[model samples]
Target chain A: MNLAQLQQAFRRWLVNASDESAQLLGSNHVGLAVYQNNYRAQLVGCLEQAFPNLRRWLGEQAFLAASITHIDNHPPHAWTLDAYPEGFHATLKDVFPQNPDVHELAWIESALNEAFVAADAQPLALEALAELDWDTAVLQLTPSLRCHDLTTNAEAIWSALWQETCAPEAVMLEQAGGLLVWRRQFTSRLRQVDALELQAVQQVQADGSFAGLCEFLVQRLGEDAGVMQAGEYLAAWLGSELIVGVRDV
Target chain B: MSTSNPHFSGYGLGLRKEHYCDFLETSVPVDFVEVISENFMVAGGQPRHILRQVRERYPVALHGVSMSIGTAEGLDTDYLRRLKSLVDEIEPLFVSDHLSWSRSGGFNAHDLLPVPYTDEALDRVCANIHQAQDVLGRTMLFENPSSYLAFEGACMTEWEFITAMARRTGCELLLDVNNVFVSASNHGFDALAFLDGIPAERVRQVHLAGHSQGRDILIDSHDSPVCTGVWELYARAMQRLGPVATMIERDDEIPPLAELLQELSMARTLGAAL
Candidate 1:
């Protein structure tokens, strides 16, 4: 037989195998069944890791069903399972439209995985700040550090997942809050942040000189929000090792 | 980093997640460790950190299941990139992947699917291997996967195909002794002849694993201890091939480190005898 017929036979056997009565070697069928099932299972298991939130929101059966369906049309082209789930959200959103939370949940979960493997680096500590001359010191977050200004209460929902009790209402935070995800000491952590503080850090990180930051905040949040309060927030972030470095003056 | 020779990292066992803690807490005399590259390919994690610690001590060799050299769809680039990154990080003594393909198009069965030994198939496999070696910038090794079936179109014996692949592609062979036993049993081939036909220079590494029998066929299940027949094959392969880098794969029903070492020690003895 030529390679084409050989390829066809292998492909057919992979799809479905018959018993040994009609087979040249009975063992090939067994290997195909077990190997095929495990191969599909690897992708499904990777989806569980990449989209834990979607998995939780959709529950076990529905989530696995969605995963199984997605993989059927989009068998993994890459050997690394990490990249395979990169396109999962688009597929899930199309399949489960009525469940709008699915998109947000998938987004948060994917971002969480992203943050989890961002890079290996150290975050700035408060001690690093103490040595800085405050007037000229411009704090810079680590490259691995990212603050997600979310539109949905992803944090609360994720927190509820940790308790092994997942209820949507449990995450009924007043506003769609902001989130900060950063990797330090090779561990990833995420948390909700206040809106004013979120924008405050983002603005400074984008292009705020310390004095300019205070002036901008005075104009935007009213003079009643003192510069010291902003400094305190910065200090708190620094203490938690969220602030990684300081830009040159 | 501790230096390693491609042909010999002394005696090592397949790095099992089960015995990770054992290796971490205390150091044993095992010379090196083999890891399934797919398991620890991601950017960062406890798994990687542990792997880092392990690499600092023992020589690490990458054994991948997804290279799919036997497939007709050409080489998978994404898989090669990931494997390259792993090679950069781990610096395994000699990188190896299965001589099998698991998918074509979109349907990925994730099994170490067998490839037929036809001339066309051989050409594709050689081209893919050459492409893979070029990308990896190193001579890669391919293992003969345990088979469940043999197509009628087999142009030559499995050994003939592997030897031709190695010779054609400038790749090395990872002589999986257990696979020989399993395939020989399932397909009624002589395992010793399978060893005899392959050029010894091509075998840079050797694998010894355990297998279990199903209702009608024997499965290359890496569970339990290495069967007596597989041991005999290992001794024969080592005798013919001389001392090659040897390791054991115990993925299922993993025993304690001591037990695995006991088996590895026996291999060390066989390696020494050879």
Candidate 2:
């Protein structure tokens, strides 16, 4: 085989380890076995490292089974191994279809991993907010911020697992909320927010106007409480360093 | 071929996360620290932050694992751009990857897969190297990788291909002694001939790593201390390539900083002897 053809064959051997691809390469079986072993082991190790909390949550055998299934279905296409773990939540969902908690926990780990390495941005200083007109001002969130609708008590489980404490049993929340992950300075932070705050953040993210957020909240809550909640969320987000930029639109 | 990279002689260690506190908080007695370029190639956060702090203390080298220069298709421009941005920032002592392919046909294996030493493979590798060098605006170094399999090839030896590659592209060489020993043992080639064959002047850096013995092959695992056989080869290598920048590369089952420093001192003593 030529260079491209040879590489394609090698890829097949690594991804599938089929007998045909091995024979086509015409290399030693012992050598090919070594390559195959290395390929799978490296990928397994990547998943294990990326989702340590997920591994703990699922227990060892179940996690390994899920990881193997993921590997079989999805051969990595990215240059960095960090990108490999981004799609693992889908695998978790497929494996544990009934367990929303597993999926949320996977999402938490993936979001935290992404946020840890996400682009650096300076949080908008509170002094900068003094000059902005609320009607026309646009607020920019940190690039590292990630959000997802959370239906289970995955946050508690994650925190407990992280602290090496006995984790509480997973249960569906009476009122579903949202999970927000972002980095503050050099540390990645996670917070569980109520549905109203989630909607407000989503509103600002969609339109970035303080007035638009107030309007959206006003329709949800009454005018007085809506505007008050907007102001409170702004203060909390700013204090948490989620607001990174402000611009006059 | 004349290389743009200048020669430096010193001993260092691969800066892994296990010893980040040791390197950042205290003064580690090493000439330079080598970091995996891909690890710090992210957009931001603590990885970059810690690297910045470490860069302030020691001259760092950017050792990458994902370049995949031997891929038949071409180079990855996005990878090159990120690496160039890092190079511009860190001004690393050397930027290097392996003479192996981990990516091809848009599927990345993330392991240092072997490349056949054929004319076609050589041409693709040289072209890829030229592209990478052009994009980075610096001469790159390519290291010899450990291999479990040798292809049914028509053309050249590993060192011969490397010599021609360096001659064609004017790129420098990162002589990995442990890889040489491992591949030699696995493929039943003369390690000394492989060592003597490469152009010494083109070699700018040396890597001394540990390997594990597999069922029938020696695996370049890089998990333990340098074995006696590999150390002896490194001593022989020092005699030929005098005063090259050498470092002890340990990747897994990492020992304490003191243990690594002690291993590095052995390299220092050998260099001093030379």
Best by DockQ: 2
Write one digit per residue (lDDT tens) for candidate 1, span A1-249: 455444455555544444432254334555556555565767888899887766876789999988877876666655666678888877887788755456667766776677666656566655555566667767666555566666666666776775677555533346655777766666777777887778777877786456666776787767767576677777677766766677558
Q: What's the C-alpha lDDT at position B73 in model 2? A: 89
lDDT (tens digit, per residue) of candidate 2 on B38-77: 9999999999999999999998999999999999989888
Off by over 4 Å in 2: B1-3
True contacts kept of each: 0.46, 0.88
Q: What is the TM-score of chain B in candidate 2?
A: 0.98
Residue pairs with clashing backbones, model 1: A27-B148, A28-B148, A28-B149, A39-B110, A124-A244
Q: Once superposed on the true structure, which residue ranges of model 1 sit more than 4 Å away at CA?
A: A1-32, A49-59, A90-109, A125-140, A146-157, A160-171, A196-220, A223-233, B1-6, B71-82, B85-89, B102-110, B269-274
For B55-144, candidate 1 gives per-residue lDDT tens digits of 988888888887778778776787788788989878788888988886676444566877878788889998888888888888888999
DockQ, structure candidate 1: 0.34
Residue A236 displacement in candidate 1 (angstroms):
3.6
- TM-score (C-alpha) between model 1 and the true structure: 0.81
